[model samples]
Target: MIPEELLLKYTAETKRFQKDEIIFSEKQTAHYYYQIVSGVVKMNNFNDDGKEFIQGVFYKNQSFGEPPLFIDVKYPANAVAISDSTVLALSKSNLFKLLQDNPETHLKITQSLAKRLYYKAIIASEISSQEPAHRVLRFIDYLKDDVYKVEGKYSFKVAYTRQQMADILGLRVETVIRVIKSLEKKGDVKISKRKVYR
Candidate 1:
């Protein structure tokens, strides 16, 4: 984890949010770089038809809001708390000052940006080159790795609803349900309320 002193030097404020609370709206000015200290945050994009699509989900210890901050643009998506969450907020000026003061931190930030770009590339490739089922499978695989624990049986707690899952995978709700059913039929996964066993 990044050192607390470094974070404190850059951060100007801190905020807490409850589950399902909106952190920011699409087109909102990017004033601060936010770091999640605990819980989860979901970033989503909406279409003109009022359909929402999830862009990404951030877990504990993750940072966001940098891209738009660097670009000096409005936030491209809306961000919401998936659970009770706390975030460190660094204003744009503070971020710039930190980067200027710590060259090493600037390098680290650049590397982080590069990694994010790579992930976006991977997602784009998967969307164009892989079948919808395979894309969903890949997403499931990611969730399994990120959120599950394995013992005698695989069990996981999901942070989002089925509809949210569908949005995250860029699939229709029916298609998401179908894939879940398929996984259940194959004995690869079992859903019990909010828990999934695989």
Candidate 2:
């Protein structure tokens, strides 16, 4: 992610958003490079019947909704504050200038986008052909092996709620609950004090 000082140097504004506020909607122009200063944000889309599909979740220090800046396309999903949050937003032109002035930062942004693309490809495959149990387990494994880098059994505490998991994985909430219980029985995960660990 771009450093805070660099963002400030580029005249990035620190904006605050309340919980559930829409930062930008789907098809809106991608005029800013946003980095989280606090709290959580999610990029998502809703279906005709109002079912939510989470594209990604970002926490403090992470960047979201930048892929469109590189592609010159409008945002494909809406960015919303999951909690009251502060974010730094740099105009697209300012971002270009900052990147031109810092080749290393440009490379870093490219690498970050590539990783997200890789994750999308992996999840897309899972949603397309995998069973509910397999999708749930693989998603957990992705977080364990890639995101958190935790290895030992039940060492990673899951932070997402069942409904959030269902949205992200394109499954029903009931399915996620059942899958978690099934994973527990299969020794694939551990549920303790109503918290899940993997």
Candidate 1 residue-wise lDDT, 9-71, digit = tens: 666577999999999988999988788889899898888898988888888777775799998
Q: How many steric clashes does model 2 contain?
A: 0
**Best of the candidates, lDDT:** 2
TM-score of 1: 0.78
Backbone clash total for model 1 is: 0
TM-score for candidate 2, please give it: 0.95
Error of 2 at 193 (Å): 3.3
TM-score of each: 0.78, 0.95
Q: Candidate 1 overall Cα lDDT vs. reference? A: 0.77
Model 2: residue 48 alpha-carbon error in angstroms: 1.5
Worst 10 contiguous positions by lDDT, candidate 1: 146-155
Model 2 Cα lDDT, one tens digit per residue, 72-103: 99999999999999999999999999999999
